[model samples]
Target: MSVRSLSATLALSAALVGVGVPTASARPATYELSGDAGGSKFEGIGYDARTQRYYVSETTGGEIHRGQLRSAAATEWLPGDGTDGRWTARGVTVDSRGRVYVAGGPNGIDHPGAPDLWVYDRDGRLLAALRTGVPNAFLNDLVIGPDGAAYVTNSNAPQVFRVAQEHGRWTIRTWADATATIATQTGFNLGGIVLSPDRRALVVPQGNVGKLWRFALSTGTVSAVDTGAADLVNADGLVQDGHRLWVVRNFSRVLTTLQLSSDGRTARLASATPTDPDRVLTTAKLAQGRLLLVDSKFDEPTAVPPYQVITMTPPRR
Candidate 1:
């Protein structure tokens, strides 16, 4: 890393955060956020239903930072603890028991699994390590199912796989993989993955095309969910709340809300309202009807502002 990058990361190391509860509304609204100073670049994020806290990953290095969202732009971040100040924390999720599962190895593209996953408890204590089941494990993100299975996003093989608890450890298999619906549409990077409330469908953000893809487990087929998905609005991260589907599009820099079809066949805009968009996206259930979002791309290293996580209140439920 360059001096600029090293110095930026150190800044993040010394930064202090607080833990507090944020207020909510009938329907969620989006809240824009303050930008990151040096490094603080993020890869994945998740919401912890049990604690109402948000977990974010810093791909710049190890460190899946935890934040207590007290309100829009108001957050408390945990300190990085490990060799270089914590493991390489990326893509995040919280199990029903509230244990956090994070992709912590193979920091960038083309990198394969070297024990790519890590598990932590409510206090950020390391609990266990999970190897990205794939050979060239470039895990982008992950989601936990009702059965407690971990569905991880693999950016390399370009497919998602299921991780089950076995032999007293997390194991991966093709049971779900064989059941996935392949996208007829090609030429896009697949990142972020989330399941519908019904757990019958898996939704992913096709990073290159700026759209969301819904994978039907029962049918074994994939297709675009939004008419605007193939269009170049720059969709990045994803998450679902109740019947609401939320999307974050960069370039246009807007956060959109949609109503999901019961069958997971379609999603449509829920409100005329939209929030300022950024390079990164992810959703979390904070308080009952509220959500917390992080925008890692405030300014680009080349294009605009340095990356940072933002807070957003989705349209009121």
Candidate 2:
């Protein structure tokens, strides 16, 4: 279908299904890291419940760092040795098996990696570097699907790539393409992604446009979500639990939570809580029953040393 038709359909759905109000509030705590490893530009966040570890990826050099839930120190899991000049990290996520997945891409138009996913063991050993095979793909935030598949969003493209282990070897494929609507419009499309509660579909947001969408894996269908607000500008990272989805607006400097429908097509704004205005925050994850966020500070004049991961309770309904 065309983008216009799809948008009209979505509008009808929003009107028929009904929309919910959004609430804004604030309550958070900050944890500082020990060294320069903490200062480099960081973006993604992931948590391993079994080991009680939190993982973050640096945007400057594709370095992976790990820290304990309550520790002030964070150590480098993968050093940013600049193996490839263009190598930069975006999103980091951990699976139930304790494996870590880090997204890598170019830092700018001049420097570009092959847009890959770096899979590592729990101890930070490089297990595999699976290339997305998509041209100029900015592989961003990712989520592990119910069937153990890894689905990654491409900020430069209008699609989500799926990576799954097959016969002990990992393979990558384009799970669904959001070719219509704002998918291919421009800048930072398909930023953060998460699966539905039932795992039958995926929900995603466009960073530049502040629009949310749902893609059905079974039928390759796409639909818009009624955010109630005109725009969720700078919507960067997304974390979901049960029926709630938390979206981090990097430029807005706030974390907004939305209550999603079971099908993942619709959401009502639950709350928008203020984050540290001095630090540009990106991704978030649930650790120890609290929400943890990374201070990416991507747009700051000079990155301050001893970066931090802030923890807080999700705003109440």
Q: Write the per-residue lDDT of candidate 1 for residues 1-317, one digit (tens) a residue.
A: 22443453345335512111123343323332222345455556777766666677765545555654444332425444343234456678888888887765364332343456667777766666556455655666788866677777765544676777777775655433422344423433566777876788788776665666677766636676764432324555665777776665544545556677765667766542334322344433334555455555435563234334443445632
Of the candidates shown, which would achieve the greatest lDDT relative to the real structure? 2
lDDT of 1: 0.56
How many clashes show up per model? 30, 0
The residue ranges of model 1 lying beyond 4 angstroms of the native Cα positions read: 1-38, 71-87, 108-113, 174-188, 218-233, 271-274, 277-286, 302-309
Candidate 2 per-residue lDDT, tens place, 1-317, comes to 22432354345435532222111233224555543633467788888999888888877667777888756567877776464332578888899999998877444333544437778889767777777667777788889887898888888877888888889888888888877654475667778888887788888888788889888878768888777763578898888899988888998977787888888877888776665556687878876567787878687666766577766566645
- Per-candidate TM-score against the hidden true structure: 0.71, 0.85
**Reference-based lDDT, residue 286, model 1:** 37
Off by over 4 Å in 2: 1-29, 34-39, 83-86, 107-115
Q: How many backbone clashes does candidate 2 have?
A: 0
Per-model CA lDDT versus the true structure: 0.56, 0.74
